[model samples]
Target chain A: MAQQHLEPTDPTAGAPPKLSTAVEQGGPPTGDALAGYLRAQATEFLRALRLHRETGTASSVEESVDAARALRRSARRISGSLHTFRPLLDADWSEEMRPELAWLSGTLGLEHACEARLDRLLLALHRLSGSTPFPAQSLTSDSAGSGPPAPVTPERGNLTVGAAKAGALLERQLTLARTRAHSTALQALGSSRFHAVADKVAVLASEVPLTPAAPTTDLRALAAAAEDRLLAAAAALPLVTAGHPYNAEALVHGLSPDPAPHPQDGPWHQVRLLLRLHRYAREVLYGGGAPVDVRLLAAGQALNRHRDASEAAAAAASAARTPRIAPATAYALGVLHADQRHEVEAARFAFQQAWQKQTVGTP
Target chain B: MAQQHLEPTDPTAGAPPKLSTAVEQGGPPTGDALAGYLRAQATEFLRALRLHRETGTASSVEESVDAARALRRSARRISGSLHTFRPLLDADWSEEMRPELAWLSGTLGLEHACEARLDRLLLALHRLSGSTPFPAQSLTSDSAGSGPPAPVTPERGNLTVGAAKAGALLERQLTLARTRAHSTALQALGSSRFHAVADKVAVLASEVPLTPAAPTTDLRALAAAAEDRLLAAAAALPLVTAGHPYNAEALVHGLSPDPAPHPQDGPWHQVRLLLRLHRYAREVLYGGGAPVDVRLLAAGQALNRHRDASEAAAAAASAARTPRIAPATAYALGVLHADQRHEVEAARFAFQQAWQKQTVGTP
Candidate 1:
């Protein structure tokens, strides 16, 4: 069978020695190997969870953020692996763990997401407003000066008038949102639900429940299936739109007043989800000690940027809709919104380039 | 008739005294009034043409740009008026003058367009690249320093690497295009064809070639027809798409390798053309000395920005396609292209706002 080609003939040469030993002595690359991989991930998640709790108020903010990030990363890997390798594990146990893991990841991630978005938007606003010297003041002063009057382009002058005000409004709104998210994250971390999840992860660190059929199941085929799903999801994205450096039509969808997630973002997010599963499945196949795939890392970073930029644009759009704002303020928000959307396009372009490079290099 | 309502009941009150005198004494507001209007426009064109020639090398670059702009403006008004009120003018003469006038306007405007695009793109690049402090140097120095290390976001660090190089490439390409356009304008000005057009305008300053039926044609009905066309075209625009602060789909059309004008831009250019005709036709209706309509002027300014930004984005996309440049440079160009599209969206938003205000105020 084609799947047999993926099996390691010299077992130690492919998977880590521990997993190879488990496969050889345990009779097959089945639930035994899968459980070993799951146990290792669970142990790592427990370590991160402990580090997160131990950091407490004594640690610097950066250290706390780092701990939370580490905790979330482990949770994501565990959850994603469970999802992709479900057939090899106890279905009810794995299914029950997935949502708890997801909740923990999402709860821990909100503050960081908010902070990154604010940073992205503030940077964009500074860049956009910085170049256009407010011409109103310059024009008036030029009229009063003894030197030959400078030529003022009326169009550039008018567009930049509200940039400062717009920046202030955005800073205020995003900062407030970030504070709220921070509190929410803190609350969630201390909740009984978080404790329950931590308790389950502690148990998982010692024991992994697996199905009886898992011992004979072909791990390679399942990993391949995970990769296939990721590829299919990616292929379905509006890559043609993403390939364009400027996507004006994408911006139109962003302008809608509905507060729900943007429809255009759904497919990209799905691809991101699938990509994580594929990455984690590969981790299991390699027995969790494989050298990093630089191309996959780059693609992940690009997708993360795509997500950040998309959210930031939506935030800017929401801020622009504030009641009774000055026209200049609204105009500035509009410009800022466009700037974030450009970042979205830029991120998508970066992803396309990185992905294309990977395909060319690998194939 | 519905057309009669557009006609002046008290001619002396609606039109300038000179046109009313021509209408009253010459029997009907026919070829005589139309010819008088044409003759006045021709006189302005002749004056502008003379000033353009007289300014020569002694003029400041600003003065030269101003003179060229003046010459183009008069040429556009004359050509547009000829198009709108064709029935009142000699068909053969009008048809021949129109293209020559268009040629003069386009040739003279090329250098200005290039310069404006360069200014726009350079400003955008400067803004985009200015915010993120170069992390590479900071990162190394931080490791050496005793102070706590700053958190460096990986995504922002990677995307900005090629910005300066991209800016330099754009500057070189646009500057070269501008120099070529400047020389082209100079060559066109000195050509025999320009002299022929100038001589024709000199003749037109004294007498306009009127069709035999011009004497009885209703000027009001013709101007109204021009307005109708403008209104219909405006109504046909995808205002909902334009209304959005960000339009991603619009950006897709921009990314096509085909160098022809973007399909999305065609409708906008058509509207701009019709707007000019309507504006000039109104100028004729008011006998040329009417106060400027602020709303029309605002809408025109917005459309001009829309055109400028759309073209600048195209220029950036073209620059990005230059062979085998660094990935960083391509990324920077992509960001720049997206920035210009944002500017395009902003301009569309501005037009929507101005046009909406006009409708509300007038109604």
Candidate 2:
């Protein structure tokens, strides 16, 4: 019952459990255990925020408004919390996180407003049904199809003889939403964690009409495949001998990207937070007046990359089993050049560990 | 069960029930029946827009974000639906019933945000209580007493992860709320809603002391007394001669002395809507970053005015019982003066209605 302070000597003191082990075995990121914790927490916050907007039991007129504020506020907190990693970010990367997150929060506000309206309509239907001396569906159908344009009329409910209200130009708001899209897309370009995935997914997200292409699959499966690939890539990144994602800060700072958020040090934790924001904003604008199936598009692209990775993983697995292509053979043949030359000891160790696991179950 | 259409022959027909009838009857407002029906439906659309914030929830992270967006879309639609009142506002006021309401939908949006935030916090509290290895009271205590420092260590439950967000300005927001306060002095100087009744309520409200002069009776009883007074004033407004709450719009529109919601024409719906908004905004801003006790404030204010108005109403009632104060008592003396004022017939009718209602029972 005590408010225990787990500042240092905690399970998360050094690094997160799964990721730390993955890195120790030489197949995933290591060292920034604190960063990982921060990232995970950010993700968790975003997830919990959804409950407010997603739960049912039709919100009251007052609640609808409150719900929208809650969504915006939680998002702001999550995005702000991401800023804690500024010292950890290399350079320009940390600077771009806030604006993107802010934009994302703004988009969330819009989205919350939408769902609340639908719920309100449902409530209205319930009320109208009760007041009318008729079945609910009859009144609904009558309102929707047969009677005057009910949606456009204002004096139709009890307890709502509200004063006149001004109407905003939807097209203006829509345009504003669209203008922000490119900013999100550009942010994805510099992100090693999500860009690679988003890029590959974007390809698959498109139409395959009468043209010769792989037959389209249902979204649910596509989404699952995409997730599988992303996680796999994440697991494999530390093992890859490229050492590329590490130098991300150098290239970004040298280039002095136009969308820089912080000038000196920051925008660290913001990178991942902003990506989520990018995802959030894109979804809101697309769902509005525009009919864009962004989710499927991302899924398709992920599937393609997933297929490629699976093939490589399979080949590597088969070769590992052949005595002729074992480590001794690879060392003699000099095919382990990457391990020796690029200092890919961690990755090599990972493969050896996998083989050991295959022979003797993990301790 | 049939969806009724407007009877073509009766499009502009039907003896419109008085305004108070709408409140008493509770189905829809009585008016140009068609206009009233349409306006009420539009109001539903607006109310629903605010509720969509609930859809922001999804079991998964992305799903939740998507849900949030869905809610915002609903809000936008709800706001857009108010445009139908534009033409109505432009209609001739030769047959104007009361002050036209304005800026109501925007007010609703503001209210929706407040409600969403409160509910989100409440839900988080619920989740924290339900989620763990210990007593809820401890968490509640910690939740209140812990210091994360402004904008730095924002915690949601026991999980405190620094995200570097930019929402440190909640206190600043609270200050902004103060700026929007509908101070009694301002209302008294400008609005003509119920100055005489409000004058009495003002004495009571002021007694709470910007600095607390002294302790008083129970807040609940005080609030009740205030509410009763407002109810009486609400009843008397229509009947009291020379009561110009109806035509004070000229000043609100820069033509007269009062600051009503502008114009003595069209629909008076937005007026009540905006009044509710002022109440809501005040509630959220002043009531401890929450909306607690706002309704009580309104009720108390109403009760105070109700008490002030009842004195006149009682005298009127006594005259009817005794059949004495014909054209001589303060009752008839005021009535004679009222008979020569603007809207004499309307005032007389309202008085008779109030008298008839009092005969049966006081509101």
Candidate 1 stretches greater than 4 Å from native: A1-197, A200-363, B1-29, B131-161, B289-291, B357-363
TM-score of chain B of each: 0.82, 0.22
DockQ-derived CAPRI band for the predicted complex in model 2: incorrect
Highest TM-score against the true fold, candidate: 1
The numbered model that scores best in lDDT is 1
Clashes of each: 22, 99
TM-score of chain A by itself in each prediction: 0.81, 0.25
Candidate by candidate, in order, the iRMS in Å equals 17.0, 42.4
Task: List TM-scores for all candidates, in order.
Answer: 0.50, 0.19
Alpha carbon deviation, residue A345, candidate 1 (Å): 12
lDDT of 2: 0.27
How displaced is residue B248 in candidate 1, in Å?
A: 2.6
